[model samples]
Target: MLYYTIWTLFYSVNFHTSMVIMFSHINHKPFLGAIHDSLSLLFL
Candidate 1:
């Protein structure tokens, strides 16, 4: 159960990171910094 939980968390973060990257590519420059902040928040 613990392993499964960890895997899920990792997967979610990875997916979110990819989505954020894609959005940053197509969106404004400000959004890139905003997502970096968000990703740091997620890590914490």
Candidate 2:
């Protein structure tokens, strides 16, 4: 039971971290674009 609990906790943490990393990576390009647009507007 203890082993199962530990495994579940580990799995959940790993899953959450991977999801966050992937989400950030996926959004990274769009985020950069937004920043670029804002900078361009500022310069304009």
Task: List CA RMSD, all candidates.
Answer: 3.9, 11.4
**Model 2: lowest-lDDT 10 consecutive positions:** 29-38
Global CA lDDT of candidate 2, please? 0.67
What's the TM-score of each model vs. the native? 0.65, 0.62
Give lDDT: candidate 2, residue 37: 53
Candidate 2 has a TM-score of: 0.62
Clashes of each: 0, 0
Model 1 bad stretches (over 4 Å)? 28-31, 34-44
Clashes of 1: 0
State the lDDT of candidate 1 residue by residue for 1-44, as single tens digits. 99999999999989888778776776755776859866787799
Model 1: which residue pairs collide?
none
Model 2, span 1-44: residue lDDT tens: 99999999999888755655565567775555655654566589
The local distance difference test score of model 1 is 0.81
